[model samples]
Target: MLTIDINKQLGDLDLQVNAQIPMQGICAIFGRSGAGKTSLVNILGGLSTPDNGQLTLGATHLYHQQQKINLPPERRRIGYVFQEARLFPHYSVRGNLNYGNKDKDQVHFDTVVGLLGLTELLNRYPATLSGGEKQRVAIGRALLTRPQMLLMDEPLAALDLPRKRELIPYLLQLAKTLNLPIIYVSHSLDEILQLADSMLVLDKGKVLVNGPLHAVWDSAEMRPWLPVKEQSSLLMATITELNQKYRMSKLSLADGTYLWINGMPLPTDSKLRVRIHANHVSVCINRPTDSSIRNILSSTIAEIIHSESNDNVQVKLAFGDDHIWANITPWACDDLALKVGQAVYAQIKGVSMTESELAQSF
Candidate 1:
């Protein structure tokens, strides 16, 4: 188990975090830029000293005030991948990788090279590599350290949208191959969905939520810093069918099949993710006549929460075990006579690709 209990002050806000993460899968540290997300991560990495508290991984004591124990960053055997790909500018990819291991051990080198697909670019200098390539090397270097845990501090932030797209899959693969837990810090919800298994939601130096991404994001804006156009809830679904020739994939949800504008990521009869935004779903009393919308799931209303800043109400609808939040105008809710337990069809309108997502095996 990875346990954390911390208290720190950054300017005006006070951060108090006490949480535990299972020693498996990625546990993303998610929040706004100044939410003290990075600070918490730094403390975990031994890069910053916490004012008070204790931290431990399995049996190793990383920090403790009462015990007066604090392990230095180097001795912690933790790997850190910073926002910038901090590769040695003068060294070739191979050299930078070789520097990760203290003894230049044969075991770590070949493993990291093969795992990160670095063999082809071994001779290339850091200056010659693309942003994605540099980041890939950075990851390989991190793996070669043979660390107990990995710390990623917005490792994709410097990369452009396209570069981020190119790198996410490889990072996901890294998470799966290495059993070591990762403390990933980022504000990007898509990145969290693509990689993290759980999250520690922080804001203004305080933790607001900490749990599985699915549980923490239920009908809430999990990360508001994400582009206003793309903020939404993510649902895990299975691949029901693939129409690759037409470039569309059908996903199986508890409610029904959700068709997305992409190829399927997982194999046939495998599970994938389908992101549905509150604004994208239109609530209707009856299934409307044929239209461009390909998804129409019948569900019962669970609850309706009004948006404080607008006339819209967030309608939570349950489909079997899954629930989707749809934002509808209060006036429209009145017109349709919506209420708890009301039968409704969540109409998914105008589906298109904003992220250059390729359906890789999740």
Candidate 2:
């Protein structure tokens, strides 16, 4: 785990954070423009110093104000991928990847090149590559350093939609293949939903919430950051079966309840992360019969959040150990007389599978 209890003052923003970030998978740092997302990442990377507090990665102390120990950026063993690729104009892909190394181990270089899909472009220069390809080369160069952690500050912000789409797959592959911790700073919720395993939300230099991505996404603290229509719940599901004739895939949840989506050609038993918007779910007091909806499951009401200013109410429905959210009119809620612990059926109108291929299938 990466433990941070640091305080820094950047102009008017008094940044203070105390949180333990998981060392495995991607931990996304998210907030508004001035929420100190990039500032906190800079501190962790030793690019900027904290005014006071302690920062520790495992057993090593990267910074401690009291102890007067502060490792420089290079000595911190952290790799940074900024918004720009920052490749050397005079060098080929192979040359840029080999710039920092004295040993220049062929095995390591080949492995990183293969991981980032850069072998075909090894002879090309940065100017000849697309935005996505350039970013891949930048990632390869960082991995070749063998750093303990990677810090990416809005790495896709500079790319267009197509470029971002092209680059996301490589990032997902990296998260699955490596054991290294990646602190990703991005303002795009779609990107975070697709790439992050954990989430750290900041508000005005303070930690609003931090935990597993699904949990944090479902938390009340996250609701205010998203618009009513964008509010959604995340689920980790397993592909239990494939219907080739209908081209639909069966996804099973924690409680053995399942949902179906337009199937991708992936093998059965594949894992998928899905997002269901609150507006897409409708609650029924009695299970609907002969409905057009393809996905309906038995659920119990866990919580009801009434909107004070509007006639809308958000209901939290629980199935086994997992939960899904629904936003319905107050009249509908009152008509059903929904209460905590009440059993009902949830009609899921849509499911957004976050896996690149599965998402594109829809």
Candidate 3:
């Protein structure tokens, strides 16, 4: 496990972070800009020092305020990838990768090249490569260093939508295929949802929440950071069927409610986590006789939350042990006469099932 208990004062901002992250999968540091996400990672990478704290990875002590133990950046064995691909323009892909290793044979060059799909671009220079390609090379360089852990700070933030999609699979593959631990920092919720097995949420340099992705994603503490229209709940389900002609997949939720999502055909029996946005779900008093919406599940009203404007309210619905949120106008809530324990039908208009939204459960 990775343990961190740190207190620092950076000018006007004070940072106090304490969390234990699992050493197996990707642990994401998520928050808005100026939340000190970068600063925390810098501390981990040995680029910055905290005023007082203790940090350890497995049995290695990276920092201890009282003991005066502090490792320099080069000795920390932590690889860092920033938002931009800071590659040397004069170096070729292979040259830049080799810069980290004293002996090329020390690391499996071919394996790293193949894993990141850089075999064809080894002879190319950084300027000739696309944004995604440059980032891939950056990752390969980091891996060649044989680091104990990797710190990635918004690695995909500089890429366009298409490039971001292209690079996400490689990240997922890295997380699954390698034994190395990763600390990913990002402000984008989509990226966190896609890659994070665990999450550490920061607000103004303070740790607000840290836990499994599902717990933190659905917790009340996360609601304020999410826009009213983008508020969502995550459902763990298994893909039971797929219709190739219609381009849709049927997922069976734990409560036995089957939901159809738009996407390329996925293998049957594949486990997935589906994001159901509040605005996409409409609460109905009774099942509609005919409707275009594909998913309508029986749910119970758990609680009602009114927005600050008071013009609308978000209804918390419970399906078996699972919970989801629905955003509707106060007038609609009154017309439907919603109350705690009332049975209602939730009509899910559509699910956002992009590559980033759907992650294969290990």
Candidate 4:
């Protein structure tokens, strides 16, 4: 586990964080512009020092206040990929990648290059590479160091839409192929949803909430971060069956409930992350007969949250072991007489998958 209890004062913001993050998959550090996301990452990467705290990754103590033990960035063995590629202008991609490893380990070099798809650009200079290509090289350079963990600070922020899309696949593949934990820092919710298995949300230089991506996403702490219309719920599901004739796939949820989406060519049993926006869901007092909607499940109203600024209410619907959110107007809520624990039917109008393969299959 990566355990930390740190504090620092950055100008007016007092950064205080205490948490134990699992060092298994990508853990995204997310918040607004001044939420101390970068600052926290810097401290973990040994790029910046915390005023006082203890930090330990597995068996090593990166920092300890009482022991007066603090490791420098290089000694920490943490690879950092910044927003910019930061490659040496005079060097080719191969040369830049070799800078971190003077030993010139060919096996590690080839592995990193192949994983990052950097072979084609090996002899190319940084100036000649595109934004996405440059970022890949930077990532490759970092991996060549054989660091205990990888830190990416909004690596896609500097890229345009197309460039950002180009790099996301590589990021996903890298995470799956390597055993090292990745601390990805980004403000973009879309990026976090696509890349992170767990998330650590920072607010005003403090740890707000941290947990599995889906759990944190469904928490009350995350509601304010999203616009009313953009509020959504995430579900991890597995493909159980496919209807080749209709081009549809059935996904099984934790509770054994199933949802169908546009067909994906992937094999059965593939894991997928599903996103259901609140506005796309509608509640019915009774299950509609002969309805055109393909996805409708029996649910009970678990919570009724009134909107402070509008005439709408957010209803939390519990179905078996999973829950989803629905946005409805006060008039509709009253007409349906929705109450806590009241049975209802949720008609999902749309479903989106974060998996790139199903990006256009909604």
Q: How many residue pairs clash in all the candidates, one count each?
A: 0, 0, 0, 0
Reference-based TM-score, model 1: 0.90
State the displacement of the C-alpha of residue 80, model 2, in Å, after optimal TM-score superposition: 0.5
Candidate 4: pairs in clash:
none
Q: Against the true structure, whose lDDT is highest?
A: 3
Extract clashing residue pairs from model 2.
none
lDDT of 4 by residue, 105-190 (tens): 89888888998888899899999999899999999988888888999999999999988988887888887787778999999888
Once fitted onto the true fold, the runs of candidate 3 whose alpha carbons sit more than 4 angstroms away are: 351-356
lDDT of 2 by residue, 51-153 (tens): 9999999999999999999999989889888889999999999898887655788988887899888989999999999888889999988888888999999
RMSD to native, candidate 4: 2.6
Best candidate, TM-score: 3
Window of ten residues with lowest summed lDDT in model 2: 353-362
State candidate 3's TM-score: 0.95
Q: Judging by lDDT, tell me the better candidate of 1 and 2.
A: 2
The CA lDDT at 248 in model 3 is: 86
In candidate 1, what are the lDDT values of residues 7-117, reduced to their tens digit? 888788687889998877788998887888878878888998889999998899999989999999988888999888999998889889878677788876887788777
Q: What is the TM-score of each candidate against the true structure?
A: 0.90, 0.93, 0.95, 0.93
